[model samples]
Target: MSINPNQYKLSDRTARLTAQDLLPTTVSAGTETREFLQKVIDILLDYVKAVNDRNEKVLDFHHPEDMKRLLDLEVPDRGVTLQQLIEDCAVTLKYQVKTGHPHFFNQLSCGLDLISMAGEWLTATANTNMFTYEIAPVFILMENVVLTKMREIIGWNGGDSILAPGGSISNLYAFLAARHKMFPNFKEKGSSSLPSQLVMFTSDQSHYSVKSCASVCGLGTDNCVMVPSDDRGKMITKELERLIMERKKMGHIPFFVSATSGTTVLGAFDNLNEIADICQRHNCWMHVDAAWGGGLLLSRKYRYLRMAGVERADSVTWNPHKLMGALLQCSTIHFKEDGLLLSCNQMSAEYLFMTDKQYDIQYDTGDKVIQCGRHNDIFKLWLQWRSKGTEGFEQQQDRLMELAQYQVRRIKEQSDKFHLILEPECVNVSFWYIPKRLRGIPHDRQKEMELGKICPIIKGRMMQKGSLMVGYQPDDRRPNFFRSIISSAAVTEKDVDFMLDEIHRLGDDL
Candidate 1:
């Protein structure tokens, strides 16, 4: 069984080899495998550079059917050559959205942090599950430290936390924790065992995940009451109190109240202090969905202004991926009370959570989560935090806020061309770009209807042109309008101006 390393030389033979010839199979093909990986890395690095280049297109637009034809997406019965695989990687990046682009103000999660990227690559190379300290010892410790730091930033003296897959799952964790805390019996007997029908409240402008959590947690969507928001998209505190009273009078148990720190479209921070006062009086769990706005906690200036009463929250869901510029899917849910997560979610699978372990079995955190196998998402955030420190993150938040303000001011200055939706509290600047045909029209239902049509058309044009990528949506009261976000710290004031100028260029002719 002696193998000759000379046989795996970097010749035409090695170039023709497939992934099957690599490690864990043909160990002698180490050189060939390294060569192939190097090629792939070059492609990725080039893509990273291109995405950061403002002149480059945010994405190469392709229809679903067209994309399918463009790329060899099918899992073949046979593997392709090493060179073909490298080409495939390049092609995949070619058509994918450049979320890191400065002009790519499409979503809450955007940015390319080199430090975090390196951590993510290292995490993948490690390829270990974050179930137990024995398995992911370093990562488990890192998660604890990072989560502790985040809890401290939230003004919590001490707390428990877990990194979930995404903000949605993190929010779901909050929901589950609240439910278990309120009705511990519901765990064994199900929702049917509850004393009464449970109702949760969230602002109408809050992330839809709140309602989704309600549905998934067996609380029923109908019971998830939507508290109305004001013209500024903040939860009307008086209306919230009124709704809670009405729900109680109807004999439903008000168990959880989710106040959004930063709404999806409008980026409005709710009156957390007022909401906290109400939650205390009503004995409801106050969970702040700071998934989008949580990065503000790092800012000395905006933290008090935006998230004043976040410290009073019983639990909080914060996604570093959104504003902190961590890689996608870095979300954490923290609880003020310790052991609640374990008591609420632990199944104590004997095989995984053994009592006979020599080490402190308390570090075996697998039982504390709903999922058995969790990905190591903490490394990127931990590494990024190490590189940036709290002050770096604060500067990033302040810069994003400044860019948002610059965008708002630009919109107001060009009021003839664009209509500001509302004064943004976070980094979301919502507005309507008035095309030539719609300009100077009297503000009415007819004008609003016409304005709605502009966003879809301009969006299509921008995609076709491959110049920019911004999100557009219609709210309950307002018609379709651009909901530009400034999540990426890489985005600049110049980019903000480019966004406005490009919107005008694309939509000026109606």
Candidate 2:
């Protein structure tokens, strides 16, 4: 009788769930359905129970074609049954599952915190918003609390914060807030009222997001002056000061200076103390893009002197998803000055949010943020924090740093194989696959440039094998180094070792 009678139906969920005419009017959760669900629960429970067991045959379930097929957006409704979906997940989607797999040294953030994943399931089911206190009181309060914790770590006393989608948007919020503090007239009349001569400075080694912000802010990408970097990719403070003085002498109003902490390619933290002094002297807004290093702010012993002068900056962007291993889309932009974000993106929504100014009108995030109907991304992170506690995240950070050190130590002890490109700064250890093709080369500029070409050849072989994955990028004129981000709490030394072995094996073939 249609497999089962009672099912998950639409009329219950207006916003997210709806009925489909092409398919069954309702999904079954009847007696048969209960039996099916019990079986499904048994399977999922087994998987979770076997989380630490990596030698299982379930790892080899999905072939290349099966994975390629799964990427397709649309297919016949009910074409993939719940049983089939479970089988595929247990088989086809093996490596992608973050079980701290020994060889899965691929992405920036890896490792499944049991708590984080559990929170994710709850959050997806709840599906709330962070726009107003009347709606999401708990999450809204948590956002403020978490942001305040970050601000306190940054040494700010009474600063404000707003959560954003990612690090890119977090940096954008900082820029917008700074712009509001500096040039409020632009909000009233747009870029026409502001000086096109307004310039910003970030290192040649800094993120592309800085230049992207320039593009979005109408300052033009050309205005994002790439200050020279040292061999280690940290921006030269003196050189930055020189550039600022030169820009000022040339009558360019230097508005912002973007200093990076644990940069993408090398995990290099710029001299924030020195940079902050320059920004303070020139009355320019300083923004520390600490998306990569912000997690370490929780690690008192190891946060380093990286963000020493952070409190002096006008704003800072710290993304928990990248470092804290909260789920994706958990980032925040904090400011020393209060209400700048509200003042920047605020619009008089007379038909909706505004008009009743007598009430607590400061009760909206849509105006302070670039997105309306922003997903309630806070709960996954807040619940994770609640479950794990701040101390757990701090220990996770310490463990990652320790893991990064282990990678460096293992690579450095070897003289001729993998080059420990830079010492483990934060959680990144960039290195290269020193293939036999470029081995024992003459110490000349020509050979140095030739070393740059070896990475892509080796990387191509790695991908073709379809076994392991680690991102590679050339940064600050260094020979292309494989950038290893130990952002995953699931990763261990064994994974790093396997990653190195894979790189070596692939490079030897090349």
> How does each model score on lDDT?
0.90, 0.72
Model 2 over residues 50-137: C-alpha lDDT tens digits?
A: 4444443213324678667754435565554454433443442344443344444556665556676677777776778777666676
User: Which digits, one per residue and each the tens of the lDDT, describe model 1 over residues 1-510?
Assistant: 111122223357767888889986898877877887887777778878888888888888989998889777888998988767777777777788889988899999988888999999999999999999999999999999999989999999888999999988999999999999998988999967887899999999999999998889877899999999999999999998999999999999998999999999899999999999999999999999999999999999999999999999999999999999999879999999999999999998999999899999878889999999999999999999999988899999998899899999999999999998788999999888998887788878888888898899999999999899999999999889899999997888899999999999998988
TM-score result, candidate 1: 0.97
CA shift of 320, model 2, Å: 0.6
Candidate topping lDDT: 1
- Runs of candidate 1 with Cα error greater than 4 angstroms are 1-11
Clashes of each: 0, 3
Model 1 residue 153 CA deviation in Å = 0.9
Alpha-carbon lDDT of model 2 = 0.72
